[model samples]
Target: MTQETEAVAEEAFPQPGPQARTGRPPRRGRALAVLGLLGELLITLGLVLGLFVTYSLWWTDVLADRSAAAASDQLRDSWAAGGPAALPSGSPSGPAAQGDPNAPNAPGAPVPGGGPTSGAGGTGTALAAGTGVGFLHVPAMGRNYQVLIRMGTDADTLAEGVAGVYEQPYRAAMPWDASGNFALAAHRDGHGAKFHDLDALHKGDPIVVETRDKWYVYRVDSTLPETTKFDTGIVAPVPKGSGYTEPGRYITLTTCTPVYTSRYRMAVWGSLVRVDDMDAKRTPPAELRRG
Candidate 1:
């Protein structure tokens, strides 16, 4: 009776498979599962990195351009509200970017502070930080391309994509200055990329600045394709490496180099050539009108 009963039970129920006998998966199978999970995690990480790159390089430009345009509008509105007497910034003899009024103005230079500036307006006053000073027009960049000019170059200010007047060790000269360097900075790759084509500016290209009452016209004099980030002298009262040993009404434009990286800097230097008063039409200077 016992033998018959045992045989019947064995036949009815089979023993557990090899996995159950060892209480775990085979080592090879376990390794493959772990590898599959690792591959999935790596793919997820790659996708996240790709998304971040797109947002940083592309989406940021869109947001920055919008902010810059709004700021430009606000600045123009402020100037309009000020009226003729308010004089938000210096006079047009009509444009030195605003800075130390007394900075060295090379003798005989047409833009002296007194006794008939190159144009009509006088050196009126200084513009406050974060305040919109004017608009930058570079014909070489694009026929209609222009960016608002503000008074600060810090991250918070430049992030909005406007060209900022430097206020550090080398106080940037005003656009209407009798003499001195009117240096400016902006992002080249992102944040509106205000100065993206700065490198393309060749000697003699017009660089205009539109203020409340005047249009300051400048011509590119030189271009430094690459420089150290710490080279503050590039924006000095008389920018180094610009080949302009004499003091004069000069303008300096700076931005990051190598496309998307900020590891270095580039600069374009210009000198004021003329100033024109803005009539009722607010017509841009001839340089701006040309396609």
Candidate 2:
């Protein structure tokens, strides 16, 4: 070949160096894999910590004393306006809430499990049951939020900071007061929000539901993580001896678990253990005043 022709060929097709010819391919692939793994790990970490950061910003850190005081004041005012004057100077007995068990009955009562089932349909049963929710309070975890009581998965209560009460009118069946399961829903983020830390509850944790002049104490019996689509069977009245049941009025609490993900829900259940007439006595720890 002519010298000129040889030079032109060399320029057109440059040879690869030692590293590029053999070692570079595998090393490059490994570097890319490491980067991919790091990216995934970072994404997961952000998801978990993002909720924590949000809660830190939104939660009020005044300790349980402040919460207790606030709750006391709210109860006093509510009672005075509703009837029976104030909650005494000290503490009172019975349910901090009061209802005649037979006060002519409202349109719909709270449903077992959570959210408004399809049973209510377009009949406004959802809205009616939604009203029965009244107020929600968790003393141990220090949370109190005004419940909105909406229906179905369409509405995300966490975004709204509202609670939901499921009621009848759907094809599905639940019991009435002292009969079937009464279910309610809220959120959990370690914030001063509704239902946060619900899953962290152990057996014997305190949960209180209030009406006007009655206070019913419900101790935590069990907590279940939502793996399936919340079986209607699980929400059955009395929990059906499934290890989460007890006598008297029972309450089933439900919420989304693992923070920001709806992939699963966490449920904490309690049965009405003690009933008190708040118009009677005054004491701390709630149990001090009996019926």
Candidate 3:
């Protein structure tokens, strides 16, 4: 009713004290600080997790592949100089050639004395295949998967789509460079990240493979979608029609289709365009051998 009374009322209601701001005691600043801290912690954790995954895959692949290649190279050299007997029988140089880090230990094939000569007409045919790098890279998908020159499930350890190189009927199959179907299989989703993008690949896309000796570039020619049970008999030793013939060094890339589902498979077929030898200075070192 009086000027003094009105002034007192205004002070009493003046922007509720920090204590009664929310109808509860103050702690607004404390609560805000806690929330901010939690958010920062979460962000830091995410970054660490992402780095761990990337580095783990990268380094493991680098070591496993390097070891396998070194061993294979030794075996090949021994065979070239003399024969399997010349290979190591006990130590690192010994029978170790047969075993794989990701595969069960087994006897490896004795080296072939007389191998395919360079340019043997077979896409991949080559005597004493130069063993340098063993991996494939798909730039489009940021993929880098190990390649198995040996046979069996060795390659499947990191990726199950394809068996070890040794497991494949190598001698029976034409040289990768030879004029015939040169098929490679990799997991749809697994380690090595092989053919994971097999289904997503479009016509004319590039498929690049690097062996210690050279880099093979292939261009996708077709994309075939078949049911999970659709025989896939084409991968058999004697491939049926499957739109491929026994000539011209065709590169067949196969992976489970539908991205993350095994209900079916997508086969992306390609033909070898050019084989570039890294050491020959035809292509840059980075492009030839992925880091």
Worst 10 residues of 2 by lDDT: 87-96
* lDDT (Cα, 0-100) at 107 in candidate 3: 24
- lDDT per residue as tens, model 1, 1-291: 699898998889867898988777799788989999999999999999999888877788899889888887877777668644223334434223334344333223333234422211123344467877789999889988889888889998998889998888677777666667888999997778888888889999999989888888999989999999999999987889998987777899999998889999999999888888888778898888876
lDDT by residue for model 3 (11-122), tens: 8877666566666544767898899999999999999998876765565445554655565567546544655331111222222222432211112222335332222122
Please list the C-alpha lDDT of all candidates, in the order they appear.
0.78, 0.49, 0.49
Instruction: Tell me, by lDDT, which candidate is best.
Output: 1
Residue 189, model 1: lDDT of: 79
Arrange candidates by TM-score, highest first: which order? 1, 2, 3
Model 1, C-alpha of 156: deviation from truth (Å): 0.7
Worst 10 residues of 3 by lDDT: 86-95
lDDT of 2 by residue, 1-291 (tens): 999999999899978787767766777888999999999999999998987676553643223224534544665566556654211211112121233222212123232344323331111122332222334556555433234333332243333444455443222111123223456665554323466666666788777655554555678877786645455444555453338434334667777766755567667777666655555443323542222
Show where candidate 2 strays beyond 4 Å: 1-79, 83-132, 143-159, 168-176, 189-193, 240-248, 280-291
Alpha-carbon shift of residue 219 in model 2 (angstroms): 1.5
Clashing residue pairs in all predictions, respectively, total: 13, 27, 30
Clash count, candidate 2:
27
